[model samples]
Target: MSYLIYFAIIILIPIYAQMKVRSAYKKYSEVPSSTGMTGAQVARQILDEKGLYNVTVEETPGVLSDHYDPRSKTVRLSSNNFHGHSLAGTAVAAHEVGHAIQDQEAYAFLRLRHTLVPVASIGSNFSWILIMIGIFAGMANLLLLGIIFMAAAVVFQIVTLPVEFNASSRAMDQVVSLGIIRNDEERETKKVLDAAALTYVAAAAVAVLELVRLVLMYTGMTRSDD
Candidate 1:
């Protein structure tokens, strides 16, 4: 039952994200921001307002492929957003700009998440190899090591939650405070932001589940030895 639940969640989450984003886009295509702002325009407004002069918003190829690369000081958006003028594009644009705000404000979670990126990258990539070796060698201690690695990944995910959430929050606030859109448009924009937020949550859930799976497998191994 637990395995089934995990599998369902893993599969279901991406499905939900994709479907929701599509729906949001479809619904909002007819609804435009009052200022006639394209996503790139909104993003540029936010970046310039925040005094992040170094940050650049550019077009990338893909659907809903928007992200903030602090390293490159770039906010890359998909074709839909780069020139999109609907609720979907607006919300996505705001959310990515939200990240820039986080960067400028020195949001703690964002900072922590950035700091953990390297550790997480290393741990997530190599922990599985270590775990596989431990399992085959029947080394109980390796299970503990695996748990540590998985835990690191989990920590990164946990920290990511606030970083993402706060970004959305900042974005929504800006959209309202700046008079960027109407109240009706606000609802649609929020819908897009809300849906996008869930993807991060789903990612965190998967990370947690993977951690739990590792712990359980390691526990079973040690218990057998005992």
Candidate 2:
């Protein structure tokens, strides 16, 4: 029953969040911004205003595949977002620029998240395998190590929440201040960004729940051995 509950949480929340984001994006993508600026223009404008001349904006393939690559100091927007002159495009472009700004400012959470990337990557990839092997082999030490790895991934997820929220906040501020979106259009733009943020919140929730489930399982195994 508990496992069923975990499965439901792990599955349902992300599905709902994705649906919300796609619905919001699709609806707003059709509504052109009054400023008539493409997403690439918006991103470049914000980057230039912030004096982040080194950061470049480019279009990448796929829908809603926009992101900032801190390593490359580039904002990669999906083709739809890069060329579309819509509320959704403007908001997404600004959001990616927000991350570039975060990278420039050395935002604490962003820095922490970058630092955790390696550990989180390794943990996410290998933790489950280790846990399953440890469970079947009755190796307490190995099980503990898997739990520790999962904890690292959970920490990364928690750190990500702030990094994402701050980026959205920055994105909104930039669009408003730069007149990329008129005052009247602010609400719609915010809706699109908020929907995107929900996906991150859902991801974090899933990671935390998974960690909790593992810990509970580990505790049960240890108790059984005693």
Candidate 3:
């Protein structure tokens, strides 16, 4: 039963979230925005209006691969979004710009997330190996270390939820305040952003579930050895 629950969280949830995002993107990507502005233009307008003059908006390859790189202060939009004047494009572009704005304002969660990146990366890379070795060797201390590492990754995932949701919120606000989309179009744009946000929620769920599974396994092993 525990394995089944773990499977659902690790497999089903992310798959469903990805399907939702792809479905929404496909549907709205074909629907042209009334503003008649390409996503690049929309992003640039928002950045400038927000006084993020140093942030560069660039066209990147791949579908739905758009993102904001705080290190370079660049908003990289997928090719379709950079050139297409579609609802999906507009929403995605604005969402990336929202991250740029968050970086400028020094959002607490975002800053903390950045600080955790190195620790989280290390934890993700080595936790599984350490846990497996500890289990095979019946070493409780080593297992505890692995759990601590996994906990770091889990904390990073939980922190990510608010960062993503906040970005979506900022995206909606910018698009509406800038008149990028009409009242009727606002709903469609929001649907796209909302779908994207679900992916992050699914990721956080997976992280939490995996951590729980590890803790349970560790406790069970200790109990059995007693």
lDDT of 2 by residue, 1-226 (tens): 9778879879999999999999999999999999999999999999999999999999999998899999999999999999999999999999999999999999999999999999999999999888899888988778889989988998999999999999999999999988888977999999999999999899999888877777887888889889
lDDT of 2: 0.93
Report the lDDT tens digits of candidate 3 across residue range 62-96.
99999999999999999999999999999999999
- Encode model 1's per-residue lDDT on 1-226: one tens digit a residue: 9789888988898788778767777777667778889999989988887788899999999887789988888999898888978777888888998998888788888999999998888889878878888888988688678678868888998898888889889988988888777778888788877777777787888778778877888889878988
Candidate 3 regions with alpha-carbon error over 4 angstroms: none
TM-score, prediction 1: 0.90
Error of 2 at 105 (Å): 0.8
Clashing pairs in 3: none
The C-alpha stretches of model 2 lying farther than 4 A from their native spots are none
lDDT of each prediction vs. the true structure? 0.83, 0.93, 0.94
lDDT of 2 at 89: 97
**Where is the poorest 10-residue window by lDDT in model 1?**
21-30
Winner on TM-score between 1 and 2 is: 2
